[model samples]
Target: MIQPDYIFECSWEVCNKVGGIYTVLSTKARTLQQQFPDHILFIGPDLGHAGQAAEFDEDTTLYADWRRTTAAAGLPVRIGRWRVPGAPLVMLVDYRQLFSHKNELFYEMWESFGVDSSQAYGDYDESCIFAAATGRVIESFYRFHHLESQRVVAHFDEWMLGFGLLHLRKYTPRIATLFTTHATTIGRSIAGNNKPLYGYMSGYNGDGMAAELHVEAKHSVEKKAAHFADCFTTVSEITAVECRQLLDKAPDVVTPNGFEPDFVPTPDRYPARRADARQRLLRAASALYGQTFDSDDTFLVSISGRYEYRNKGIDVFIDAMNRLRTSADLPRAVVAFVLIPAWVYAPRADLKATLEHGAPTTAPLPTPFLTHWLHRMDDDRVSNFILHAGFNTTDGERLKIVFVPCYLDGRDGIFDTPYYDLLIGMDATLYPSYYEPWGYTPLESVAFGIPTVTTDLAGFGRWAQTVVSGRDITEGVAVVHRTDDNYAAVVNESAGALLSLMRCSDAERSTIAAHCQSLAARAEWERFITYYYTAFNHALTAAARRADA
Candidate 1:
């Protein structure tokens, strides 16, 4: 039971909600805090803006003394607590002060660790500066406290912070380093570019692919950090294979992402919350299409996550909805919502007016398919797909697709409800991902007792197989097998799975929902957090070995 006396976790997403890594850290924070208490510290870049106030509640007095010491050491930090379920201790550092030293730092990284920053562009420089600044913060903290004998572990998440791990290795050798890549840059790039990743994964040289795809700098730092760290880890078994093939280093352990259901409403409050969500969803649909849908019979289905059209299976989801609409012997009215966030100009004024009026509409609202108007409707993939399919949200259509292009943070103008609030109202979710390292959306859906249809390509779908062991969609998780060429088959399977759920009796649906929640319990941090300890131990043990050597 080798334990870290202090755990310093750093990520670009800490308190900065950009993507899935934020959920991974924020959800797991409470469990880690319980074990380590105040010893667990999270570090993130403090982009000087007002938006951080919502997620980070700063407490200058909490670390006033140490913060002063860090300031004197040339590293100014905002000591605070992340405003999440755990409310863990967080230090958001202003790394912009180090921008002048960026070139010198990049030069040092290139000379010392062979990290090629010459080809870096876009956010590459900013991420590197932040990473180096984060490392300096840890170094200063260690020296200020004079805890050389402490078993300290500094964990870096994703390639964005890989340079920090290298920084720690060169300057603060006493701190055990662990680097976890949630997804490889080259792998995601290959998928995004419509290149076949899995088929040619064996022959693909990581460096070559990175150069060709113009992600050389990120891949360079990440690959080097993977080899240089005391412990290299990834989030899932599927990603481990990616690390081995792409990064050229097999992970020491797999730390699967876990969730906490603390936000789940109490048993007594469940029905009311669900009913409220259903009413809001129905109201929005009625306002858009001008026809009231039966709340009890209308099946609420959704697909939510980052707007990755092909990667997150948004394209396939639309295809399935199209298939369901055109098929015969349909069971119920299906209202599908594409809840993924996109670049929105503003909330549709007509939709807002309709929602506020609280009246069912029969005439279609202008641009009825989308809840919000986007800046570049011409370039929007989802909108283009819906239009290309020639499906409109007319009163005669059985299936309707509502594109919510804004974050549902209870103030998206249309829903006025947070994601979880709306998620609970869903009868089923479809996340037939083509390149999901670990599908958090589907996991969240199942956690809320909404049965989900996901492909085996997703890490969660693969892990669900072990939970029920040979049970099919009856277990509330329909795992569809998907390959590079199985696009049409996957769409058909997704549609068929939804049809099965619709055909299920009310009692059967309840049983399936119960089973969904049951499976979600197995994925809770209480059970899955043990793997994190494994990675921590590996990091500490490797550090001890290197120190002795």
Candidate 2:
């Protein structure tokens, strides 16, 4: 296998934790660091206040000489270490200085690579400016270090950073470029718009759909980057299919996302952590409902991700919980949590008071299901579903739904705990996604030794089906077969899967938990990082051939 002397990976989510991409990069950092040592660097946009954020610990002296040179060249950056497991070196580039040159950059891109920014709007301008800045940063570093003859790779993730790959290819043709689209822009738009994406994927035209969805600018950049990059890659086989159809390109490698075991508690501490998590979760639910819950008899489950009602299957998850509420075979009382963040106003004061003081001796608090108050409570889909569907957690109800519409970043008032802390409390997780390229939520759940129910439509779910034979919760993951037209079947299957988890005996549950951990171990970066090396070798060879030509 060929290896680059230095690897520079750029993403909009390097130190910024916006989405699953953050998880992908942060978890994989340690493995990359182990292989490359200090030779690997990450580049990201310098959101103004990033220096003060806990995720970034700045160090002005580590790269002082290069920083001075780059600053003089009109690229301002902060050298730091991302506070992930590996603590890898990071460079947060302030791209605001390039905004004034946006028009010129866009024109050059259009002339050189046919990237159309004519129909750009929303975040297009900002993202492209940042991307161009990253390209400049990489070039400046390469020149300052006199690395023209060394093997180097610049990897850009998602369409948001496509412009950087184009800029690098144009300015530094010798440096190999890799572009990975976690999900195609037009493909996600098609699914989000309630179109039958899977059913009509074969007949759909990428350009035509881009025009129809008003995503022409993003689609143009993404498609061009994929075509122009020395190596193109996506997260999973499912998304590779999307790329082949929607982006008109096939990935050189399918690099499935992986997790690090460092985040999980060690064996000696695991039991105590699990017990504490269960207690806190039960206490919070009991406080909200004005009823005590027996931790032994209550099954805690959750569905968390971006608040995409249809795409992330939040709607189906809610329906599945409703199905479980009335099922006679549900062996344990369920406290299902919807942990997706939304436009939240604040944590509910009454719930906080109850958590601080005690559960009221009287009736349950108003809006007993919500831990936080959303800004548009009247218009929120999850809130509306709970109310309209009569998800009343009465004195004797077997199922209760709690809507946690705030990011649990250890400061979300009520829980005052980070997402991972709360995630350990879940007995099972449901991610019945309709268009997930790779379902990280379910993967994260299983990594924490919690059985999960995911649909075959998700990339992770499809991968899980190949690893386990039965497709049951007993195997720690139940990959339910989901199609665009089978909403009802998906919900029923998901509910039944959860029921199966709840009904497991203590010995059976222990076996399932072991299976969960075993499955997660198979997906560690140690196993998955070879695909990345393959992609790197492909890019390097292609770039070498281009240089020869």
Candidate 3:
């Protein structure tokens, strides 16, 4: 292994209880340290989130002069650090002032541009002051580690730290810069502040919200980051195609993201582990919602993701549930529809209300994004519609739809919740990520020893088809192809496949789940993290050659 001496990173959600970026950063911390003998300094702006930083130990006092130096330089370092498993060095770039003021700056930019997010997407440009200061702050931290003459490399993930690369690129210790766009900023930009259910779209433009600010021309941040860094990447292969076409830069390599397989037990060791996971799910469901449910009596089909009603095929799922429930000669199966949607803060008033009212629609749910949040909405009326919708609760036939709107701490929620147990017990995982750069949830659900149904648009689905012994068009976890001329036929066929698995013998289900888990392990982080090290090495080798020239 060509271990580098340093690795620097930035994340807005590093300390904040935000998105998948936290999981990505925390997991990589220890692994990067193991590879780098000297230091793998992680510099994320803390805001108030620094207090909740995991792996936190007792605080050490920093000299006022050094703190003042950071503040004077505008980086405002409030240091609290943690060394995760397998990491060599630990450094927290806690900047309470800068982080806390992000909202203020977001609005200031909006006001200064004379436009509001209500009309167009809101984007806070941090390529200037913040990047400049953070670059200096990181430089100081890096110098301390490289005093022993360490080969240095740095990474800036997403637009949040786009400036970090710009600031760090010129420094002598800056061996290589790798920029990754987890998702296109321009893609998220048009969505403005819309809820996931209401996916926002704008005509393709690189300038993005900058157009509202009246910049003469437009450009992609992906392209900008590519130009700034020595190498660039997206989350998956399909996403790479989109990036190349849209951003005008092809990623050098596809560093696919993966879940830690062992995080959730896969029942390969103990045959009864599946039953135990199911029992746990039942108990948690009863405890959390005051409703008794049996794992056998309940057939669980879940939709977990950012709730893009169309893109995620949330519409298709609900419709299929309705169709499946009402089919003739079909046993009145006790089916539970579980949606642990991301962006729960977005208003789901009408969507949740319709479920409450038992009013079904063939078309998508009639709700727009940017609606304020409404939670704790389970009333007797909603519960009644869900229970009495069509099947028999009296003799083992009913459809149960549960919308869990809280944060799923990997350890507590699905990760550790009866959720995985329930997954192991479920009929199938439904993932119709219409625009998935790559889908992790379905891949993960399978790793929990449950089969999944994903669409072909995802990078995972494409790869799994190559390596995984997939379910036939009749019974295995399938990737639904939407572009087929017969869309209805394809969907109906997938529904039949799902229904068969739901009614399969216990032994058959276990066999499929085991196969799925084995497929995922082949692509787990053990193989994927090597990509990060390799990508950095590629960039540095190229950089060295350039210097010699």
TM-score list, all predictions: 0.98, 0.98, 0.74
Model 3 per-residue lDDT tens digits across residues 1-549: 454666766655554445556656765665565665436666655444524545444244743456666667556566545544453333345444465565554354334332232332233343323543466677765554444355567777776565556556556424677888877654444322232211222234445444543331113334565766777877887767656655667888678876665456533643576676556544433332334566675666766666555555565565566567666645534444444443345434554444345433333332111112434433322223344444232323344345454454444323244344445655577776556666777876777767788877677777777774444522345877654133465457556666776676768876876777777777777677888877887777766665567
**How many angstroms is residue 469 displaced in model 3 relative to the true structure, after the best TM-score fit?**
5.4
lDDT of 2 by residue, 409-428 (tens): 88889989888988988899
lDDT string for model 1 (1-549, tens) is 688999999999898877889889999999999989989999998876545443788887886888898788677899888888878999988887788888899999999999999999998998889899999999888987987999999999988898889998998888999999988999889888888877788998999999999999999999999999999998878888989999999999888889999878878999999999999888888788877889999998999999878989999999999999888877899899999899989899998987777766778887778999999899999999999988886666788888898888877777888889999999999999989999899889889898999988899988998887523566989999888788999999999999988998999999998998899999999899899888889999998998889
List per-candidate RMSD values in Å. Answer: 1.3, 1.4, 7.8
lDDT of each: 0.89, 0.90, 0.56
In candidate 2, what residue range of length 10 has the lowest lDDT sum?
Answer: 47-56
lDDT of 3: 0.56
Candidate 3: lDDT of 95?
44
Error of 1 at 302 (Å): 0.8
Better of 2 and 3 by lDDT: 2
